[model samples]
Target: MKALYFTADKMMELRDIAVPVPKKGQYLIQVKVCGICGSDFEGYMGKTGRRTPPMIMGHEFAGVITEAPEGGKFKKGESVVVFPKPFCGTCEYCKKGLVNVCTSGICMGVLSADGAMCEYVAIDEKYLIPFSPEKLPYDIASMTEPLSVAYRAVYKISDEELQASDHIVVIGAGTIGLLVTAMLSYRKAKHIIVSDTQEFRLETAKKMGAHTVVNPASGDFEEAIKKATDGKKCDFAIEAVGISATAESSLDALKIGGTAIWIGNAQKIVSINMQKIVTTELSVRGSYVYDFDGFKKCVELLQNKVIDVSSMITDTYKLQDGVAAFKALENNTDGKMLKVMLEV
Candidate 1:
């Protein structure tokens, strides 16, 4: 077996390693496609402390099962998408169905756990969701993890609030931001406003059903949001960029008592307008990764063509070209790259 290892900051190496053997209740999956996430990029750059060095770094992957426990719920030759986060069922958070935040859980590819940036991975049955490759390609199926993040972020707001709101804004046109826009489109949001510094991403947001796309690099972002909403601002704002400017802009683009869902966590801390939030009664909520049900829902949504993400995959590289893949994302100054996939 071969594996791509994140050896250090801005460094990756492909090395030959022994294949993993499946445990008693685990399934051995031969990875087909894996997508590099924003967090992975941060790890590559040594920006986030979540991922350490000398580990396989990939969680959004899809593969075919080659070995499984006898008479298990899934069998050999089954195509599956990994949930990536394996949680202890006995944990308090897991008992409450908040498995995403289970204290005893470990997210594959983050920290010390070796993930699927390799030829194979042995995943427990509880973390695998079987899917048909005919309905969803391996590359697209690998996006289930990020799509689930988008789903949970959009659905964080209640149905009543989402329907009652006339204006909604999504800050940042990255993968999560674009998917959030698509989910808003699926929910039939009245006016979808997407903001980003990159014009290419703004254009892509338009293609993803954004009613108004604003480039902060062009003009004032808050003014653009106000103009787009006819001076009412937005009823809801989803911040997908975890920087200080974008996080503040999400609050600035909202009307009184508007809700802001913080989905991106690139920055561990960002300054915000506390007085404005207090005076306007604004609500800011942090949305983390998705639970099992959310992941399953995203899988179904992708398989059913409810959310078309084929365009989101901007580039693909062979597993052996892992370093080039990371460099491509690192040097994506024009913002043309959206999601980069590695074919194993």
Candidate 2:
């Protein structure tokens, strides 16, 4: 099998490697499509230390099952989507159903474990979900991870007693931001505002159902958001960019008593106006990756065609062109990139 491997010198190389055998209680999947993620790019650029090099680099993926446990729910040669997160079900966090934050959680492709970049991956049988090819395409199935992340963000809003179609603001117009906007649209948000410095991404947001797109680099974004909402402010604000500035922007866009959710990976710290938060009675929270049920719900949504993830795929590259795909995603070249997939 040919795979792209991260090297000790921080390089990507395509090499032939031995195919892995499925152990007892594990299922082997022949990789069909694997999407390049932002975190992967960060690791390649030495921004994130999750992957130390000499590792496979694909987690968001879909494939056909080549092997499964006897009498398992999935059959050999069955099409399916892989849930990237592997949890130790006995952990305290897993006991509470928060598998995403489990202390012993192991994520394929991004961590120490072997990922899906290769032609085949052997995963735990319990982490595999049967998918209908007629219902969901392999390319779209590769987006299950991002969609699940988006679902988890919306799930956090459930405790606030907010209604669908409420005024909402989503900061950042990247992949997650765009996907989150689509999820919010599915929830029937009446007014959805997306903010970003890049005009092209903002335009994509509009096509995806954002009612308003703001360029924060040009002027006062908070003022523009307030004016658009008639001063009532957004009922909910979600920060999709993993940075302090965007997090603050999300908080600033919220109305009094409204809630704000941070779903992005922010490595640095951002100062918040504590006085304003207290006086306005605002609630700010952080949301991590999806729980077990969130991944299942994401699969259901995709299988039902509730969200058009197919359009999110901007480009596809062969496994040999993996380096090119990562570079394009990193540079955002031609404004022609969204979900870049490796055809393994």
lDDT (C-alpha, whole model) for all candidates? 0.93, 0.83
| Candidate 1, pairs of clashing residues | none
Q: Write the per-residue lDDT of candidate 1 for residues 135-170, one digit (tens) a residue.
A: 899999999999999999999988899889999999
- Candidate 2 residue runs with Cα over 4 Å from true position: 8-10
At residue 147, candidate 1 shows an lDDT of 93
**Tens digit of lDDT per residue, candidate 2, span 226-323?**
88888888888999987768877887898888888888784556777888789999888888878878898898998898888776788999988987
TM-score of 1: 0.99
User: What is the number of backbone collisions in each predicted candidate, taken in the order shown?
Assistant: 0, 3
TM-score of each candidate structure, all chains considered together: 0.99, 0.94
The reply for model 1, stretches above 4 Å from the true place, is none
